[model samples]
Target: MKLSDLIAQFITDQLTGQDAVELQRSQLASRFGCAPSQINYVIETRFSPARGFSVESRRGGGGYIRIVRVPMGPSALLQHTVAALGEQVDQSGAQLLLYDLHKAGILGDECFCALKACLGDQALSAVPQPLRPRLRAEMLGAALAALAAEQ
Candidate 1:
């Protein structure tokens, strides 16, 4: 396996049965026989907010990296997912997020269909090509914010 994959798998193993895990980057590098920057790369790529994980790091001698698996509920996960989204998002990513929310019982069938229709490329086809992604992102953000506000 690739070094990054190995590192991600190691962290995944550590995350089982835990809400979060903290480790020293240098220690992980030493354990893997790789440079510390390699650890950073793995964390950045593998533990992304889109993937339902958050990584926070502290610099200096006593600093550590904390990897927290965001709670599985819809509100927290949806907030994290939407907050992490860039100004532009594609259809597949939006669908995946909505699907996750639906499966988690955060969205019912009617709400899911409504949001899916709103996010569809066809629905946004009237907009300029370059602006569609941003529009979709805005719509999603609004929807999520509404959901969050309802609670």
Candidate 2:
């Protein structure tokens, strides 16, 4: 596994049976023999709201990073996710959201993979480059909204 993956796993382990975990950034970096930025990268990519996590951080000598696993019902999760999204969503962001839904048991493996591919870059390749992200966001928003309504 990659260093980032290992770091992410370590942090996730700390959250087992707990809603949240707090760590000093420098200390975590020291434990992994990496820079503080490495910890930040892992937290940003792995613990984002799209993955059902929310993070808070304080910077300074006494600073710490807090990763909170959000527990939400399927319908609520879908609604919250749609609300959290911006005007555009890249393929990776959409995948993150799909993965979160799958993890929450809201989406089956086949459905998740299907949606991922449907919203993927290659599927949108014929569209104009600048327009694809916008179209992707609209498509996902509608799909999630419909899913929420079904719940």
Candidate 3:
């Protein structure tokens, strides 16, 4: 795996419970010998709800970064469901799946928010009509992967 991927895996492995960890971006950046923005990029790209993880960050001095793991429903079954959808999904279908996830308590408020934001109208609005479905599917998949990883 790439160094970033290794670091990301380490961070994920470190997460053991509901309690979140407060990490300093600069510290991590220093450890990895990369820029702080690189750490941000890793968090933004890897720590997402679809992967079973969520991250909350605070700005300014003494700010803490918290990473939390969300549980997965039906073990690996949901992954099959997501894969079946492929790279294209309609709004109704996405909503229905998300609703199911919410009802199951596999997804919490913050997770819902992150998924919504990713699949939200604003993100979808910018895409061309023909590509919107595929983009939405990719976004959903990424978001779900991030959430699933947290578990």
Candidate with top lDDT is: 2
Task: List residue ranges in candidate 2 displaced over 4 A.
Answer: 35-37, 57-64
Off by over 4 Å in 3: 17-19, 74-151
For model 1, residues 1-151, the per-residue Cα lDDT tens digits are: 8989999999999999998999999899999999999999888666766467888899889989999987655567767877877798788778876776776677889999999999989898889889988999999998887897675
Candidate that scores best on TM-score: 2
Give the alpha carbon lDDT tens digit for every residue of 34-114 in model 2.
999999989977887657777889999999999888887788778877887779988887887788778878888898888
Write down the lDDT that model 2 would get.
0.88
The TM-score of candidate 1 is 0.63
After TM-score superposition, what is the CA distance of residue 129 in candidate 3 from its true location, in Å?
12
Number of backbone collisions per candidate: 0, 0, 22
lDDT for each residue of candidate 3 in 1-151, tens digit (9 for 90 to 100): 8878976876776675544666888788888899888888777556654445557788777776787765556445356446545777777657666766676677787877677677755767877778877888887877666666666
Which candidate would rank higher by lDDT, 2 or 3?
2
Q: Weakest 10 consecutive residues, lDDT, candidate 1?
A: 70-79
Each prediction's RMSD to truth: 5.1, 3.0, 11.1
Q: TM-score for every candidate vs. truth?
A: 0.63, 0.73, 0.48
